[model samples]
Target: MGLLLSSCVPTSGGLPPFVNPPASTPYGGEYANEILKLPVYPRSRTLDKREFGNGNSRVRFRVEGVNVRMIYNFFTDQIEDAGWGRNRLESEGQNRTWQGVYQRGIRLVRIRVQQEGNSDVYVLEVTFLQ
Candidate 1:
Protein backbone atom coordinates (compact mmCIF):
# COMPACT_ATOMS: atom_id res chain seq x y z
CA MET A 1 0.00 0.00 0.00
CA GLY A 2 1.09 3.60 -0.53
CA LEU A 3 1.11 4.36 3.16
CA LEU A 4 3.32 1.38 3.93
CA LEU A 5 5.90 2.30 1.33
CA SER A 6 5.97 5.96 2.33
CA SER A 7 6.60 5.07 5.95
CA CYS A 8 9.71 3.12 5.02
CA VAL A 9 11.46 6.12 3.48
CA PRO A 10 13.84 7.75 5.92
CA THR A 11 13.08 11.45 6.36
CA SER A 12 16.06 12.13 8.57
CA GLY A 13 19.52 10.63 8.48
CA GLY A 14 22.88 11.15 6.77
CA LEU A 15 23.21 13.48 3.84
CA PRO A 16 22.62 12.24 0.30
CA PRO A 17 25.73 10.87 -1.39
CA PHE A 18 26.11 13.85 -3.71
CA VAL A 19 25.97 16.38 -0.87
CA ASN A 20 28.94 17.20 1.33
CA PRO A 21 28.82 18.06 5.00
CA PRO A 22 27.95 21.63 5.85
CA ALA A 23 31.00 23.78 5.26
CA SER A 24 29.52 26.56 7.40
CA THR A 25 26.65 27.00 9.78
CA PRO A 26 23.51 25.06 8.87
CA TYR A 27 20.19 26.69 8.19
CA GLY A 28 19.23 29.64 10.43
CA GLY A 29 22.88 30.34 11.08
CA GLU A 30 24.98 33.42 10.38
CA TYR A 31 26.66 32.23 7.18
CA ALA A 32 25.69 33.00 3.61
CA ASN A 33 23.33 35.84 4.38
CA GLU A 34 22.43 36.32 0.73
CA ILE A 35 21.03 32.83 0.20
CA LEU A 36 19.16 32.98 3.46
CA LYS A 37 17.13 35.94 2.20
CA LEU A 38 15.00 33.71 -0.03
CA PRO A 39 11.85 32.21 1.38
CA VAL A 40 11.99 28.70 2.72
CA TYR A 41 9.03 26.36 2.41
CA PRO A 42 6.90 26.19 5.51
CA ARG A 43 7.68 23.23 7.77
CA SER A 44 10.52 21.99 5.60
CA ARG A 45 13.54 20.36 7.23
CA THR A 46 17.05 21.51 6.33
CA LEU A 47 19.04 18.58 4.96
CA ASP A 48 22.34 20.03 3.81
CA LYS A 49 23.91 23.42 3.09
CA ARG A 50 27.31 24.66 1.94
CA GLU A 51 28.94 27.97 1.12
CA PHE A 52 31.68 28.45 -1.44
CA GLY A 53 34.61 30.82 -1.37
CA ASN A 54 33.31 32.70 -4.40
CA GLY A 55 30.34 34.04 -2.44
CA ASN A 56 28.06 31.40 -3.92
CA SER A 57 26.20 28.82 -1.88
CA ARG A 58 23.73 25.92 -2.07
CA VAL A 59 21.16 24.71 0.41
CA ARG A 60 18.91 21.68 0.36
CA PHE A 61 15.69 21.06 2.20
CA ARG A 62 13.03 18.34 2.43
CA VAL A 63 9.29 18.66 2.90
CA GLU A 64 6.34 16.29 2.92
CA GLY A 65 2.51 16.25 3.12
CA VAL A 66 2.17 19.16 0.70
CA ASN A 67 1.09 19.21 -2.91
CA VAL A 68 4.05 19.38 -5.26
CA ARG A 69 2.47 22.11 -7.36
CA MET A 70 1.88 24.25 -4.31
CA ILE A 71 5.49 23.87 -3.34
CA TYR A 72 6.60 24.85 -6.82
CA ASN A 73 4.36 27.89 -6.91
CA PHE A 74 5.46 29.07 -3.49
CA PHE A 75 9.05 29.47 -4.54
CA THR A 76 8.22 31.05 -7.88
CA ASP A 77 5.95 33.66 -6.34
CA GLN A 78 8.10 34.45 -3.36
CA ILE A 79 11.24 34.74 -5.42
CA GLU A 80 9.62 37.12 -7.86
CA ASP A 81 8.08 39.14 -5.09
CA ALA A 82 11.55 39.59 -3.67
CA GLY A 83 12.46 41.44 -6.89
CA TRP A 84 14.16 38.58 -8.74
CA GLY A 85 13.59 38.55 -12.49
CA ARG A 86 12.51 35.28 -13.97
CA ASN A 87 14.95 33.95 -16.51
CA ARG A 88 13.28 30.60 -17.15
CA LEU A 89 10.76 28.20 -15.75
CA GLU A 90 10.25 24.62 -16.82
CA SER A 91 8.56 21.45 -15.67
CA GLU A 92 8.74 17.90 -16.88
CA GLY A 93 7.66 14.35 -16.07
CA GLN A 94 4.05 15.49 -15.73
CA ASN A 95 5.01 18.23 -13.26
CA ARG A 96 6.77 15.87 -10.88
CA THR A 97 9.77 18.20 -11.17
CA TRP A 98 10.15 21.96 -11.57
CA GLN A 99 13.11 24.31 -12.06
CA GLY A 100 13.38 28.05 -12.19
CA VAL A 101 16.16 30.57 -12.61
CA TYR A 102 15.86 34.12 -11.47
CA GLN A 103 18.14 37.08 -11.15
CA ARG A 104 18.32 40.23 -9.04
CA GLY A 105 21.04 42.61 -10.12
CA ILE A 106 24.23 40.53 -10.34
CA ARG A 107 22.93 37.68 -8.20
CA LEU A 108 21.15 34.65 -9.60
CA VAL A 109 19.18 31.92 -7.92
CA ARG A 110 18.18 28.56 -9.28
CA ILE A 111 15.50 26.56 -7.56
CA ARG A 112 14.60 22.95 -8.26
CA VAL A 113 11.94 20.86 -6.63
CA GLN A 114 11.46 17.20 -7.45
CA GLN A 115 9.30 14.52 -5.98
CA GLU A 116 11.07 11.40 -4.82
CA GLY A 117 9.56 9.04 -7.34
CA ASN A 118 5.98 8.33 -6.14
CA SER A 119 6.64 9.28 -2.57
CA ASP A 120 5.34 12.38 -0.82
CA VAL A 121 8.82 13.60 0.03
CA TYR A 122 10.09 16.47 -2.07
CA VAL A 123 13.67 17.67 -2.18
CA LEU A 124 14.37 21.33 -2.86
CA GLU A 125 17.74 22.66 -3.88
CA VAL A 126 18.45 26.37 -4.13
CA THR A 127 21.70 27.64 -5.54
CA PHE A 128 22.74 31.21 -4.97
CA LEU A 129 24.65 32.63 -7.89
CA GLN A 130 27.53 34.97 -7.35
Candidate 2:
Protein backbone atom coordinates (compact mmCIF):
# COMPACT_ATOMS: atom_id res chain seq x y z
CA MET A 1 0.00 0.00 0.00
CA GLY A 2 2.85 2.45 0.82
CA LEU A 3 4.51 1.83 -2.55
CA LEU A 4 1.24 2.57 -4.34
CA LEU A 5 0.94 5.93 -2.55
CA SER A 6 4.56 6.92 -3.35
CA SER A 7 4.05 6.23 -7.02
CA CYS A 8 0.86 8.28 -7.04
CA VAL A 9 2.63 11.41 -5.75
CA PRO A 10 3.92 13.96 -8.29
CA THR A 11 7.57 14.94 -8.51
CA SER A 12 8.98 18.48 -8.13
CA GLY A 13 11.22 18.18 -11.20
CA GLY A 14 8.14 18.31 -13.44
CA LEU A 15 7.34 21.79 -12.14
CA PRO A 16 9.04 25.12 -12.82
CA PRO A 17 12.54 25.21 -11.32
CA PHE A 18 13.59 28.01 -8.98
CA VAL A 19 16.92 29.82 -9.47
CA ASN A 20 19.82 29.47 -7.04
CA PRO A 21 22.41 32.25 -7.18
CA PRO A 22 26.28 32.15 -6.93
CA ALA A 23 26.79 28.43 -7.32
CA SER A 24 24.36 27.94 -10.22
CA THR A 25 24.82 31.48 -11.63
CA PRO A 26 26.01 34.98 -10.81
CA TYR A 27 24.36 38.20 -12.08
CA GLY A 28 26.90 41.00 -12.26
CA GLY A 29 26.36 44.13 -10.22
CA GLU A 30 23.85 46.61 -11.67
CA TYR A 31 25.27 49.44 -13.78
CA ALA A 32 23.88 52.15 -16.07
CA ASN A 33 21.22 53.46 -13.71
CA GLU A 34 18.87 54.20 -16.61
CA ILE A 35 18.81 50.64 -17.97
CA LEU A 36 18.74 48.98 -14.57
CA LYS A 37 15.16 50.04 -13.99
CA LEU A 38 12.84 48.23 -16.40
CA PRO A 39 9.89 45.88 -16.02
CA VAL A 40 10.90 42.34 -16.90
CA TYR A 41 9.63 38.81 -16.32
CA PRO A 42 10.65 35.20 -16.88
CA ARG A 43 8.99 34.96 -20.30
CA SER A 44 7.96 38.56 -21.01
CA ARG A 45 9.78 41.92 -20.60
CA THR A 46 8.64 45.58 -20.78
CA LEU A 47 9.61 49.20 -20.28
CA ASP A 48 8.05 52.65 -19.83
CA LYS A 49 7.54 55.03 -22.75
CA ARG A 50 9.74 57.88 -21.54
CA GLU A 51 13.26 56.64 -20.77
CA PHE A 52 15.36 56.22 -23.90
CA GLY A 53 15.28 58.72 -26.78
CA ASN A 54 13.55 61.73 -25.31
CA GLY A 55 11.65 62.88 -22.26
CA ASN A 56 8.51 63.41 -24.32
CA SER A 57 7.14 60.01 -23.08
CA ARG A 58 7.81 56.71 -24.85
CA VAL A 59 8.17 53.07 -23.79
CA ARG A 60 11.73 51.77 -23.58
CA PHE A 61 13.13 48.75 -21.75
CA ARG A 62 16.01 49.13 -19.31
CA VAL A 63 18.22 46.09 -18.70
CA GLU A 64 21.72 45.04 -17.63
CA GLY A 65 23.90 42.04 -16.61
CA VAL A 66 25.64 39.33 -18.64
CA ASN A 67 22.64 37.31 -19.68
CA VAL A 68 20.71 39.32 -22.29
CA ARG A 69 21.46 41.87 -25.04
CA MET A 70 19.26 44.41 -26.84
CA ILE A 71 20.10 44.65 -30.55
CA TYR A 72 19.24 47.75 -32.52
CA ASN A 73 17.59 47.56 -35.94
CA PHE A 74 19.14 50.26 -38.10
CA PHE A 75 16.24 50.48 -40.53
CA THR A 76 12.81 50.64 -38.83
CA ASP A 77 14.13 52.09 -35.54
CA GLN A 78 11.95 49.93 -33.30
CA ILE A 79 12.80 47.15 -30.85
CA GLU A 80 10.63 44.58 -32.60
CA ASP A 81 13.45 42.09 -31.92
CA ALA A 82 14.89 40.50 -28.72
CA GLY A 83 17.28 37.65 -27.90
CA TRP A 84 20.72 36.83 -26.30
CA GLY A 85 23.82 39.01 -25.95
CA ARG A 86 27.14 37.27 -25.35
CA ASN A 87 28.48 34.14 -23.62
CA ARG A 88 30.43 34.54 -20.35
CA LEU A 89 31.19 30.83 -19.93
CA GLU A 90 34.14 30.84 -22.32
CA SER A 91 35.40 34.47 -22.16
CA GLU A 92 36.62 34.09 -18.57
CA GLY A 93 35.08 37.25 -17.03
CA GLN A 94 34.53 39.45 -20.06
CA ASN A 95 31.94 37.56 -22.06
CA ARG A 96 28.98 39.62 -20.97
CA THR A 97 30.65 43.02 -21.04
CA TRP A 98 29.36 45.53 -23.60
CA GLN A 99 30.53 49.11 -24.24
CA GLY A 100 29.40 51.64 -26.82
CA VAL A 101 27.60 54.90 -27.37
CA TYR A 102 24.01 54.04 -28.30
CA GLN A 103 22.67 55.91 -31.31
CA ARG A 104 20.24 58.83 -31.00
CA GLY A 105 17.13 57.48 -32.69
CA ILE A 106 14.28 55.01 -32.33
CA ARG A 107 15.86 51.58 -32.85
CA LEU A 108 14.47 48.15 -32.11
CA VAL A 109 16.50 46.69 -29.26
CA ARG A 110 16.29 42.90 -29.01
CA ILE A 111 17.20 41.05 -25.80
CA ARG A 112 19.18 37.86 -26.30
CA VAL A 113 20.29 35.29 -23.69
CA GLN A 114 23.84 34.04 -24.06
CA GLN A 115 24.45 31.66 -21.17
CA GLU A 116 22.85 28.30 -20.48
CA GLY A 117 21.43 28.45 -16.97
CA ASN A 118 18.64 29.90 -14.87
CA SER A 119 17.18 33.30 -15.82
CA ASP A 120 16.78 36.17 -13.37
CA VAL A 121 13.78 38.46 -13.91
CA TYR A 122 12.77 41.72 -12.25
CA VAL A 123 10.60 44.85 -12.73
CA LEU A 124 11.64 48.53 -12.75
CA GLU A 125 10.51 51.96 -13.98
CA VAL A 126 12.13 54.07 -16.70
CA THR A 127 13.62 57.26 -15.32
CA PHE A 128 14.72 59.66 -18.05
CA LEU A 129 18.16 61.26 -17.90
CA GLN A 130 17.50 64.86 -17.01
| RMSD of each predicted structure | 21.8, 18.5
**Candidate 2 lDDT score at position 128:** 17
For candidate 2, write residues 1-130 as lDDT tens digits. 9999977665665532453333532443454554567544343433322233343223344333223334333343333233322212122342322222222233322333232222122222222121
Q: Residues 60-98, candidate 1: write the lDDT tens digits.
A: 222221111222233222112122244334445544544
- Provide the overall lDDT of each model, using Cα atoms, as 2-decimal numbers: 0.41, 0.33
Locate the minimum summed-lDDT window of 10 residues in model 2. 121-130
> Residue 98 of candidate 1: its Cα lDDT?
49
Hey, what RMSD does candidate 1 come out at?
21.8
The residue ranges of model 1 lying beyond 4 angstroms of the native Cα positions read 1-95
TM-scores for the candidates: 0.31, 0.20
Show model 2 residue runs off by greater than 4 Å: 1-30, 44-67, 76-130
